[model samples]
Target chain A: MTGRVIVITSGKGGVGKTTTSANIGTALAKNGASVVLIDTDIGLRNLDLLLGLENRIVYTLVDVVEERCKLKQALVKDKKNPNLCLLAAAQTRDKSAVDADQLKTICEQLQEDFDFVLVDCPAGIEEGFKTAISGASEAIVVTTPEMSAVRDADRIIGLLEAKEEIKSYRLLVNRVRPNLVQTNDMMSVDDVVEILSCDLIGIIPEDTGIITSTNRGEPIVNDENSPAGKAYINVAKRINGEEVPFLDINEPKGFDAFLAKVKTFFGIKG
Target chain B: MELNKRFIVDLSQAKTPADIVFEVSNILENPEAANRKIWLKLGDVSLNQSQILSIKSLISSINSTLSLIESECSQTELAAATLGINTKDVEEELQAELSTLEAESPKDTPSEQYIPLVDYKEEEPKESEHEQQENKEILDENKQQQEEIENKQDEQTTQNTEEQPAVSSDINQEENKKDEEIQNQLDSIFDSEVKLENILADDKDITEMQNWPLTKEAEDDFEIPEEIMTDEDYAILQMNTQYHKQTVRSGQVIQSNGNVVIIGDCHPGCEIHAAGDITVWGVLGGIAHAGCKGNTKAKIRALTLNAIQLRIADSYARRPDHIKNIYVEKSNTFTPEEARFVNGSIVILKVNDR
Candidate 1:
């Protein structure tokens, strides 16, 4: 079956682009859809580590493009899920190793076998980012709820709109802290979407579990209890063409409200 | 006063004189058996005076003296007595020794006191002054030792006749317990010394195994070209070595026609390629490719071989995923390692091993 190619990109670095790609890909694979995650961030790849398939990678995307190894030989299977695979980037070579046409060709060949092809794009609008987007028909622009990130997201959206190959693009505002938003300390999800005038696919809360999960090289979506994991699962469901409602991140939970009341009773500003 | 230590070599299982000599020589190979008093415990093997003299000389060769011999054979006991080696009952002598040590140190447990039989050399310098003084007094009590031995012998004879079966069974149980304790003590001592030798032996075995080259001539699926090199090619590679004395950071690439040597850390994301060998004097945390030009004899050596990927010839190996440390913490101590292509796989070894 022909697969839909989607690129996960963020113009600014460290905006959870790799984390989003890993979680969404894992969530989709766990739903029984065969998914392949391609990390195009050559020379500084982290997607293999996130999927815990770093050691399993022998050949990579550059090896496939250079004809050093076959395309099938470079696909490293996930440790836990047979339905998931990873086409890692070459840690020794830079973006010049594989061009845009070569990536598009690889993606086309992979589309015949898998149900979804998720390309984890590098942090920039340079040649690396261009080559990553060349193979995708859909885009997910991840951004934190901050002015700089939103501004970068706007630029990325503009670039995606200009590219005819990217038929659809959506916004995923990550690291949205509800308490900080309620206290007017951080930008709200609505503000980020309104500024960019883009439809929101997901709003992930700031969860400290993400750090430990990243270090452990496991996707946060594997953890069923984490709020960020639930959000990512919901995003995956939306991508599967299911109408899932957004999480009520704006509302303070019962425990949080109780803690705030206790603080106010202790003569502290809540 | 320094207490004279006694090491017991139990050869009761040896059936012949040859077996006894072989076992004694093997035990003496351990440096711990040197320069101490040795007590030989032989089972039913008969020996003459000349045989006992040879054994005594063998013990003395390592600066050790054969102070005592306990033999169940009358001929062996006669020969040992003629040789002036104290012929004593091992069980009675052991009882006396334990009583003396316990009287000197009342706070030690039975197992701790038992350690002196095999662990005296290592524990000597740590002896307390009060313990030394007690040892001196115990050594000077020759009359008391003679009296204690006579008293124990009398008690043994009476108990043996009164409860013959029970006494035999008790002796069997105590002998088994003592054997296990000695075995454990000897294992602990040999483990530290034998570990390096085991690793070196393993390295030798791996090197001796036939290693087929993995170039394109090997019918490999990878598209690496086969370039056969002669001995002269390797000599040229050894001559044309390049040395860099700086930290190789991320995104940097170092390529050489022959060998490449980096005197600093090679951080992750950096690449080092050489036709021959790649040596890193510091931590290697990047991708290192030796034999990039299809020389199967190329090798990679590093102070800390933490490279994300190591490539020798056409064979490559990635760092196992269980190694979670993406960043190798800089430290003063390092275990240098060398990686070479062996039997179509990359094998790493400690550098200090021959």
Candidate 2:
């Protein structure tokens, strides 16, 4: 079966779209499906830095679109996974260098080799945003549960749904802190999902590992030790058609899961 | 197992070209994601042989359905028009070609005289004289109860769109009915160049935005003197200003939870501080201060724009919109309109109830 091209985008910046792309693309690749992470955030490119493959990018997405370099040539292989490739964005040029039509063609070509093409969209609803989602088979709209992010996410989700492929779109809630939500200071996943009104693919909790990992140019999902990383792995598994249980962050250490683990060990049916 | 070649019409296009949309359409048909894989692609160009064929039929069906939908759309459009959309105009358009048919058939006149359309009023303002004409017209025109109810509902829905959105569930049922397919025979007209007409106006700016013919730089930040003038007296004076200082830190967006007032004619150079709601009566020709301090619920309303910069709080939309075409007809910006945050983008609707 051919892979689906998923564009991860958020209307407001710093809402973990690039993070989701790197993590999901890498996670999907780690599961043995060949994945390509196409960073469409031109001028303000960060996916490469997040992926920790910034130095290997001899050519960027603009190069591929402009035909300065072949699609395969511009693809920088991640150090850990040969299955995953990072098609970096052009830092020198702006978003207009690649239009939506060109992106569609690029995705079409990339679709032939890969099982999944995950596009990391630029922040705003500009040319970069349009080009990023041009050929995506579906989209995973990333948003925080915060009011401002949710409002922007609401708009983006509305725009995405107006597209014919609305059914293929799912949401990814990132940088969510369960404690803040519990305290009512932050909007909960339920509130965001309700407003956005889309099927949710993943929920990433606010973790310090994300910050440290970001600084190291490595996405938090690559770290198996982190709780957020496990969640991303589970999401990747779900995307790949595997039946995986969600890790309830609020109740991960609670009695319900504690009892469920006991039940699994005893070979009892759940 | 035999392969089924059922014709799948792509009713999904004519909107956005998003991936989740294509994937979801394919996924809906086969949620199992097993068996033969089908590609649901988007393009004005024919994607494949069957898809090309499918798109043609889809377009025709959509057009035909749109005709039916336009009746509902027109009914809503009429309902929306506060000035009232001329329904008889549409009816006359359909009958224009039928005049030859009527000329051929002499019996058409006598039968038409007996059938009184309950909803149809043979008056200039059909909506105004509803009581006596409606009760008698329904008895004369429609015999079916269900059709009468639906028509009555249509009459109540004199609007382009209904808010409170409770009617979304019922909208589909109304769209199925066949309507008189009459093209707009009347010359479509647009009323533009809003008549400010010596209304009480306040204006001033930091620096005017792009290619505006006039630029005014006023150093004085004028004050809105709290003299409670009568609405009529207030309407007479044309007030204006430059900047109403509110401390906005770097990277901090401006926001207002309520209707915000940008007290001056904003220069293209001025950075506004606003969130929630913003209302600038004067020309907004500069940078919009939005989401200032990270409040995203803000929106800006201005009389005119030839601005250089725009920011929705900390999120800056620099020199945001370039009005490419001001077509007289066939555009949302067909009249003097107001822009509000709708969907993801700003939609220009009639300034007041129209």
Candidate 3:
């Protein structure tokens, strides 16, 4: 079956592009869809690490392109899910090792076997980004609530719109601190969606669990208790053409809710 | 003439050179230290000749002559020696003085008073002496073992040379047979770079190769053959060794035609490629390719072998996924390991095992 090729891109660095790609790909796989994640960020690939498939990667995309190994031989199967696979990037090589046309060919070949092919794009609108987006028909622009990240996301969206291959693009606002947004210190998800004038697929609340999950080499999506994990799962569902409602992260929880209630009892505005 | 009273100022506990000076100055502030000969005891803090002279002058300011200095550091001792001060080991001097006191004491005097002082003084030195003896024995054993190994290797080489002519015609046939067996085994192991042309010629279906699971069972696919040094090992030893004395950070690639010896830590993401062996004196946390030119007998060794990937000849092994720590914790203790091509797979062995 032909697969839907989606490129996860962010013009800014450290905007959770790799993390989103890993979690979304994993979440889709957990839903029983055969998925393959391609990491095009040569020399600094972290998608494999995030998926906990770094050691399992015996052959990379470069190896497949250079004919050192077959295309199927380069696909590293996921540890937990047999339906998921990863085409890792060469750590020693730079973006010069791969070009846009070569990646498109690889993606075309992968489309026949998998239900979805997710490309984790590297930061910057350089050769690496061009090569990453070259293979995908859809795009997901990942960004934090910060102005700098939002601006970069807008630029990435513009670039995606300019490309005829990218039929549609969705905005995923990540690391959204709800308390700060309530205090008007940070932008709300609506403000980001309004500023970019784009469709919103998900809003992931800032979770400290992401750091631990990254260090542990496990995707945050596997953590059912985490709010970010739940948000990511919802995003995956939305991607799979399911009607999943957005999470109400704005509501105060646990200790914060207790403090808010105390403030309300005293007739004080919180 | 009356003999001068000796006052010992022990500042051995002072951690830094500045701390030692501060403590010595604080002790000299006391009025009781005046008119006495000062004996300073210092720890492992290295003091230069000028610093020793300054300390001497500070002692002299209290009208006490700096007669002796005892130090644990050899550099400190050398400095004290240069200043014409008697540098002695505290225990040795105490032992000598105790011996003198015993000789001078009358036979009728009670020996009970001397017992405690003798016991305290002897305990530390006795244990240290025992440790020194044990260290010497271990060194001797290591040397003997090394000599024996060298002799055995020499015997093997001589035997190989003598048998070369008789079996020279059969060597090519045997090598072809071994190559066929290795080709069969390559599919089970992840040797992507091995015999690429042959694999392509065979036109094996890509889907036919089973994806090896990342488990203990996959590790068992690697056969750790018995440790036997081949001619390739000797050839690697004969290669020139390049010494590098800097931290190899990420993105930096160190390539050498012969052996490579890095004196610092190889951080994650760096690449080290050597035609012979690759040796890192510190932590090897990056990718190390030993025998990059296809010498199967080459080795990769480090004080801490936490390399992300170890490649020797055509066989490569990545760090197991179970090890979640992408970056190895920087620790003082290290289990030195060496990786080499054994049979058809890469095997890691503790360096001390040899």
Best by DockQ: 3
- Identify the leading candidate in terms of lDDT: 3
Sort the candidates on lDDT, descending order. 3, 1, 2
DockQ of each: 0.23, 0.01, 0.27
- Chain A TM-score vs. truth, each candidate: 0.94, 0.90, 0.94
The Cα error of candidate 2 at residue B8, in Å, is 94
lDDT (Cα, tens digit) per residue for candidate 2, span B125-203: 2221122243345345434643644453343233221111111121132322211111010001111122111101122
lDDT per residue for candidate 2 within A173-219, as digits (tens), equals 88778767766798888888888778888888878898788767777
Runs of candidate 1 exceeding 4 Å displacement: A251-256, A259-270, B1-239, B294-296, B342-345
Indicate the docking level reached by candidate 3. Answer: acceptable
In terms of DockQ, which candidate is stronger, 2 or 3?
A: 3
What is candidate 1's lDDT per residue for A1-270, written digit by digit as tens?
899999999999999999999999999999999999999999899998788766556678998999987787778778778788899998878899989999999999999999999999999999999999999999999999999999999999999999999999999999999989999999998889889999889999999999999988999999999999999999999999999999988765689788878887998984
- Computed on C-alpha atoms, the DockQ of candidate 3 is 0.27
Residues A1-270, candidate 3, lDDT per residue (tens digit)? 999999999899998999999999999999999999999999988887788776556578999889999889888778788899999998878999999999999999999999999999999999999999998999999999889999999888888989999999999999999889998999999999999999999999999999999888889889999999999999999999999889999878789899999999999995
Each model's lDDT:
0.75, 0.53, 0.75
Superposed Cα RMSD, model 3: 22.5
TM-score of predicted structure 3, chain A: 0.94
